[model samples]
Target: MANPVELTILIEKIKAKTAVVGVIGLGYVGLPLAVEFCKAGFRCIGFDIDEKKVNLLKEGKSYIKHIDEARIKTSLPLFTPTSDFSRLTEADCIIICVPTPLGRHHEPDLSYVLNTTRTIAQYISKGKLVVLESTTYPGTTDEEMKPILEAGGSGGLRAGEDFYLAFSPEREDPNNKDFSTSTIPKVVGGLTPQCLLAAQTLYDYIVVRTIPVSSTKVAEATKLLENIYRAVNIALVNELKVLFDKMGIDIWEVIEAAKTKPFGYQPFYPGPGLGGHCIPIDPFYLEWKAREYEVSTKFINLAGEVNTSMPQYVIQKTIDALSENGKSIKGAKVLILGMSYKKDLDDTRESPSLKLFDILQKKGAVVDYNDPYLPEMPKTRKYSFKKTSVALTAENLSSYDCVLISTDHSAYDPVFIASNSRLVVDTRNLIKDSHKYKGKIIKA
Candidate 1:
């Protein structure tokens, strides 16, 4: 229902890079997006409820490890970071990059998304374009947000008429060298055709490619499928890992051999557990949504079960290693190598290392951790550990009864750790030369 005149005006503003782009939630997803928008020559305003983050941006500092301070300093002239919701009126395009976490019962928790929508509704105006970049289930943009924006907000301006709405899931991979925010392709879906055009034109300036989909629901489902595919495949390898461990088969060597086939397969390695913001949580959004239609996601549910039980499996491996050394599980000093989920990054969101730490301490093992990326354990939604990273040294490694490698960081010297430690429980298969160590290493 939007007039061609209004749509043309929005497109022109984006083409000329004159539009004021606003991004809500200045976390890993939102901050990079705002920086990319600024790099595309648009004036970007970043909003966050946390004043600490806003102050850090104002000081030209970068909190995330992968995003350099040089990038933040360079974009300081065009970027504005603040906690003011009233400034929403000044933006021609608004993007929501808030968190969509799972509830205690694994239900899709849309509180952050819904609260952001209500706030946007208060200040949105005619001819403004609003796109959601937060990952959620299908029908969230049209079914949840459209009704709120159309109900007496912005003087009852109708969606696709006086205003525009769309969904483009945020694809942010922190510390990924091959893809940056601007280089990644964006899949955008709109509530209406005009809405799609408006949103796509705005994103075309920042991203390498814009893939326009049919509806917001399709875009929403696209994100879920991407993550659920990863969750399922990882679970498959993890299940196989346990089975192979029983048969004395090396899953790592099997993956190396299987990946020799160039055409038919993609390699997904198993680890302590699923980590990061997306894979562990995003699949459940679709699983939760499926329940409304009387459908059961048994495959996804079983994958979740397998991935969730990995930490316990790692714990049992530690116990077995300790027992073989004639040491009791309780009162044994165990050192954990690397706290981050993956190698070479400081991001600890939903990291399996945290679960390992918690389980080790509860089992009466004196646990300590070391990570070159993190000096201290970061506070997360579910964890609060008053512990700092322990230094990894020859003497320090030799002092511990057992050393468990939870994360395979590039900085770790597998030979040094294997040689120094009395017992090494290798969860990530870091110590490949176990033959030379002579029973020093045990693959978990």
Candidate 2:
């Protein structure tokens, strides 16, 4: 049981907006969260190992595409961006929002999360609240984090007794115009009942709603379930897309028609493949953990296979479309549109667009890319491109043998692209209903 006196003091600080909230890993998730805490009247300190991100935040310059520079500038008064871990001592509440990426073998590589936890443990004190917002397996909080934290803290500082610990998964949808961090309902679970209450009170100041669950493991599982649901459904649709293509049925049209039902149907569109930080990677964490229980995650494994194969599927469609025009891929001039995973954002982690780009180039096709978000291709772990974004103009569009729409950004004018391009391989169905470019389009 937690000391009632200590819990009360922490709750009081959160209610009065006087808590110093320390947020770690200032990326897509952490940056917005830190901003929300500051906006909610709490003094926030953001920590990141990356010096460039810290400098940018300190200067009120936004590196992320969706996070506005003006918003960062306005929040600078209440938000302190730093790389120093020693400043953790000033915080009443600390939130870890680091990356939980997969390893080379598709296993959960928790190095980032674990390292962040170790640092927090070194400076953690009694009466302080610690929360993890990183996505991972169920056992991560209780099995991995709790032990490390307990060992690092002072003898008197006990979880749920002297101090508090919780897991609150981050639900950050980058570039989503409708729901900001404050509006998204937060899910929090703790090592104990008192830990849960303290975390709930802290989030109540920022988010519109706070859902308290049984334990930290449940909270971790909740995040995995949310992402796995997306991965499985996306795979289902991607598989359907292949079958529908052979039957000459437009999967996009079928989806629009199917979505009219007022019950039990949520539409998940088919894309080049799974992308982003969560959908492409989070499911695998559960899959790896399931092996410990001597069970198989068939759906997850199958989804991985089907979704992973989509880039190749799109490539084949491109080759077929080119062959129809009496052109071989060996000498074809191909232009890839959209480098980022989704539209209106600049994040490209696990983006299938890169895979498509690599495949196209390897097959002897001359490949170029144009993304308003990314002017030049950044070096990735598996692939590196010495290419700059091509100018999207009438002459430029007409110069390509095939224009492949990998990401359906809102900035693209479907009619203009279809009218200008010699052949369009639209994997995203961006130009699906356009009557003007119907003749030049091939729905991949």
Candidate 3:
């Protein structure tokens, strides 16, 4: 097959580092990827609907924690952050990195993806490459987006010919010192062979490597599989955590000992619950898609059930810890440590801590939280705490009836927390040397 003129032009521009790249949704995934593209010598136009984020980036400031302002300042010459959608025509390549959250019923919510596509279609022209980096169910690029773009204002322009289309799932691990957007291997899939090549060539300039798959669905499924693998493993450990608690065995210690064998075992830690954008939600995308094919994803559904049940388990542990301390959960003064999903990062999407907070408040416990990373609770899709982090002082720590350690951020001093608190519920296994603080600690 002859390469489309769009593909040939895009490839030439990409190699020459002159391609004007446009990235939509400048959040965790988009911001880092756009910065990498700028560092790779491409002039990138970063698009976001949030005026505050756009304005901050325009002034070389970063809203995301791990992405330093110095990096944004350095990329300012080549990176332009804006809320303008009409400027889409100025770019030779566009990448969509919007959030693919689940709806109320756990169905795949592609409003962000589809709305961005519709905006791109308005300004889309010939000889441009379009790629979707949002994590979604298989066939989204081909089935949902392609038709929208084809029937868009471009006068029924053909995909893979008029404009290249592809799916390259984002692999963003925030606060992981080991990996960044540029270091991670990107998986690219396209609607056609030319679409694949164009997308792969573009990512090759910024990323370490590009793994090209047969089709867009394969690429989408590849991402789901990566997260689902983690989801299932974590669910296994979560289920074991409940059982091991009854058996008087420490799941963390068991994992540490089991991981010594190295060959047959990989360790997945149990937390309060699943947090972050990918693992907690990505599996459901596949599960929801499986329903259309009249297939039952029993294992995946079971994993979801186990993972979702973890927050309640954490609550039960809290209740038990309080009861042991000669108090009831009702009217007990409780303080939650760490508001963000994971330790040391401010990204709180799907964080189980929110669920825990709502449950505790509903259960009539006086709840407050402290996270060094998050000062005030921001409004989320399903939660609105309207509270700021209390100072982690010795007096403040001693005041709470029960102190629950949800995120084991490195900033937290285990000894200090144990010495001050009346009772503690340790979820992340944050405290070590249990003999010294035996009376205060309860591992959830």
Candidate 4:
């Protein structure tokens, strides 16, 4: 068990802003968090297994689009980025912000989280506070992480006694200008009361507000519930989109009207499909975990099925648009607008745009993409397109048989695209509903 004196000393360090904050896996979640701690007058150390990321950060460069390089350069004196794990002993607070992606069969792959915990246990000392910011299924922090960390450490150090442990899921919305890391309300849950207090005290200094829950399991479930709610709601709208289209009803106009009611409704817009790191993947983690307890997640599975079918639905729309002008899908020139999953961001993880590109290529269409954020197509596990981004100009747009609007990047001129393209299959409803481009627009 940890000595009470040791716990008190750690709390004093945190309150005084004298604690060294160590953040592991400095990607989307960790980089912003390290910056927030540094901005709050704490000396921060960032750890990542990627040598390229470490080297870049060492030179005071920012790789993420939303994070400013000036912030990283100015905070260099207080922040140190490295790949070494031996420095783990120096930090008073250590937070794990690694990725917990789904595997081939959509199972929760905890390799990154477990490997990082094992490494931390080797050098973790008594009275140190550890918090997990990675999203996963319930019981992960208590059941999986607690066991690995305890077995790897020595000196009979136990969680909540010899050391403190907590779970605080990351709620990072990339490219969102309104709410930042410091502005977003944080949720924290711990193994014990002391553990909760230690974790909450550390975050109170960084975020605007911190909400403490009952246990780590609740914290884990909280994140899953948030994403699952979005997934099911988005799936509901996506299914309605197809049905409304067949009934000769415009879903966008319907949404605009329904939102005016101002009661018993929260509007969620339909897209080509669900994108981003959270909505498309997080729900499946709960679905996979629920199976272990002999339970079924029918809503999650159905949402997955509905959202996954949107790419093909879009392809059929493209084919229909081409056929209207006496053009066949085979050997047709198609230009995909935007490649990133969301608007104004460079992240393309699990993007529906890539799936659309793959299906278009396999169906014998000549496909090209243009995104101001992404100048070149990145290589993924299933795709290795060496194609570079095409320029979005009147002359370039006129050459394609159909222009497909996948991602509604703000930089794209929807009016200009609709005017120049032979036909516009608007998946995002970017084109204005006016008579100028009446015949040219086809909403997917």
lDDT of 1 by residue, 347-432 (tens): 89889999999999999999989999999888988889888898889999999999999999999999899988999999898998
Residue 196 in model 3: lDDT: 93
- In the range 1-444, model 2's lDDT, one tens digit per residue, is 688998899899889988899999999999999999888889999999889999999999999999999989989999999999999999999999988888889999999989988999998888899999999998888889887888885755678888899999999999888998999999999999999989999999989999999999999999999999999999999999999989988899999999999999999999999899999999899999999999999989999999999999999999999998999999899999999999988988889999999999999999999999999998876789999999999999999999999999999999899889999999898996744664578887
Rank order (by lDDT, best first): 3, 1, 2, 4
* Candidate 3 residue spans exceeding 4 A from truth: 1-3
| Candidate 2, lDDT over the whole model | 0.92
What stretches of model 1 exceed 4 Å from their correct place?
A: none
TM-scores, all models, native as reference: 0.98, 0.97, 0.98, 0.97
Position 21, candidate 2: lDDT: 98
lDDT of 4 by residue, 71-188 (tens): 9998899999999989998899999999888788888889999999999999877889999999999999999988877876675679998889999999999878899999999999
| Model 3 C-alpha lDDT per residue in residues 303-420, reported as the tens digit of each score | 9999999999999989988898899999999999998899999978999999999999999999999999999999999998899999999999999999999999999999999999
Which residue pairs in candidate 4 have backbone atoms (N, alpha carbon, C) closer than 3 angstroms, thus clashing? 2-161
lDDT of each: 0.92, 0.92, 0.93, 0.91
Candidate order (TM-score): 3, 1, 4, 2
Model 3 RMSD in angstroms: 1.0
The local lDDT score (0 to 100) that residue 105 gets in candidate 4 is 86
Model 4 — which ten-residue stretch has the worst lDDT? 431-440
